[model samples]
Target: MPVSHPDPIWVTDNDTLATYCTQWLKLDAIALDTEFIRTDTFYPKPGLIQLGTGQEVFLLDPLKIDNWQPFAQLLGSEQVVKVLHACSEDIEVFHILSGNKPAAIFDTQLAASYAGLGHSLGYQNLLKTLLGVDLPKDATRSDWLQRPLTDIQVSYATLDVVHLLEVYQLLQQRLKPMPHWNWLLEDCSNLSNGDLYPKPEEQWKEVKRAWQLRPRQLCVLKVLAEYREREARRSNVPRNRVIPRGSLWPLARYMPDNIHSLSAIQDMRHSNIRHYGEEVLSLIEMARELPGEQHPKPLPAPLPKAAKEHGQRLKRYTSQKAEELNLPVELLMLGKILTPMLRSRLEYGLFKLPEQLQGWRRTVFAEPMVEQLNQPEQ
Candidate 1:
């Protein structure tokens, strides 16, 4: 049966929120979820925060409630375990709300993944699969920022957290006997780390076609992406609003030195070029003028036929290892994460494993894989 709570009390101001959070701090655990919109903004526009304390459900109107400091304190309190699911964006909303991240969180989705519930499982599906309950997801596209949310919206949002406590409890029971059961706790604790979001200076690596750019072109793309990230943070607009990413590679490739040359780049919006005209020109000119020694290292050429053959061996190794452990291949190490390093080793004879491949992954697969990674294909 679906768990039921009293009709959610709509808390629109600080005093009620303070009262609720005061009681919430006394609890050992709570279920949490957020309804937010990020359609046109760099930062998510918080609409509603749905909190479940096992005994009660509270719907906090972030638009109307200005003081979230108490709830933020509750989040940071050592005793309270905040339960959530697939919570990366929810962390962002909480950060914007109170300048704090929830500490001691249990991500049921991640826990369920380990419990044989599968990767990236949705809350509704987990409920159906584990608890035999069907959760309605009708209000998924509702405008949460709009006031006077309909009954369906409230019901949908409330359902997001109401049964989460039940799910968390069931997941805990299911996960308890697994070999790496504690891995969920470790992964959950790591989620609270301050570096969950992308660093602006490091954002350039996420751009498409980035690896194709040469040393100087890469330098230009890096600086341009950094500028856009910082600008998005400053103006609270999406990065694409500043300059579309596809436009970046061409600008770097052509080394557009003036407004006219920039205009010739197919994707650079004319209005954006005019607005940031001088600044963009100066950046390109600076890259062009960099001394040869100061230029970044050249991009490695494509892999040779022998290197391509070696990749097949790596793939077979990953599949065999995953089968032995009875874990998803991705949980071992994603192809994107593993193959890139292998390619780099073949291309430049350099090897650096991704930070994510450490801890449990290192013990299981990484050590053996690294030993054979450099061996010629059999």
Candidate 2:
């Protein structure tokens, strides 16, 4: 049985947290995790933070305290490594709540992928696979915001960080003997930078089918989406409640000029039309008047038979190489990575490979695969 630390520290205020941070800076690394919910709003509501060094574990009540300066300083400190598991959301939370992005990060999920354990291994699966311990799943959906958290809830939350530290230590030791340690670190540090979190309004144009629309349609969709996002933020309501993606298509397609035209459209609620009809129509009118190529053409049909054959050849070669390495083929050559290159090879003939098809991927898998594909069948 694993030894338990009965007296886990709980910091409910800023002053006590400051002292903890001062002490935490002395540690080599800390394991961190967060509990949050985003079901009702655009942003996550941070409930509790579980942090563990080798000697102690802490549960921080984010709702009770305002200042996180000391914790932020520790995160910004290059001396201490911040270890987390599949921590993309946790990283976002840190940025949103504290405005501090940790400089040094070690993500166990990334490490696991590089270690050939497969991509996106769940936390419980990882603990079992690496440590031979079966964790309880009872608290998976517990209401974290409720006060006087049950002892079992505390125990479950504490284990999230406590076992995380153990997993980090083992993975670090295992990865220390491998060639991809620096690469993993590079990737983790890149993830630590939070610049990618707050996506700009115009960038939403990249969503699927946005380019397929006429300029007027694109403009209408953009305005509706922007309104939905802004209203979601202002009202603290879910984006779908404000305006569903389903409604955007018809509005953009038909370009309704009034509430009657809008109401005639399917899947639009009468109450919603009464409330937002004019605003929606006004946006459509603005889009219709925007001067440019009004109607854009649809995307070209999929590649022909000859192109598909080449793609198959490339996929087969990559699969064989992945088998030799005992790794998942998708890890080395995902569909997104291969599709464009395959299409280019078919259309353009023997082009210089993309960067993704070069480097470690190429040397380990792509180059040999390309050679095999080029060789004529006996």
**Best-fitting candidate, measured by TM-score?**
1
Please give, for residues 92-207, the per-residue lDDT of candidate 1 as tens digits: 99999999999999998888777767888898889889878888889988899998999889988888888889888888787788775777787888889747557887776777
Candidate 2 structure, TM-score to reference: 0.85
Considering only N, C-alpha and C atoms within 3 Å, which residue pairs clash in candidate 1? none
Stretch of 10 with least lDDT, candidate 1 = 294-303
| Number of the predicted model whose lDDT against the real structure is largest | 1
Q: Which sections of candidate 1 miss by over 4 Å?
A: 1-5, 302-305, 344-356, 371-378
lDDT of 2 by residue, 1-378 (tens): 453554689999999999999999999999998888888877778888999996788999998979998889998999999999988888777877788887799999888887788788988888888988777767867778888888878988888888777888888887777656765786787787646334435433534556556666776776777776776777777766666656776777788897888887756787667666777788778867877665333443456677777777777777777777656666677565665676667666752356644346656666666666656668
Estimated TM-score for each candidate:
0.90, 0.85
| Clashes found in each candidate (C-alpha, N, C closer than 3 A) | 0, 0
| lDDT (Cα, 0-100) at 265 in candidate 1 | 81
The lDDT of each candidate is 0.81, 0.76
Question: Candidate 1 — number of clashing residue pairs?
Answer: 0
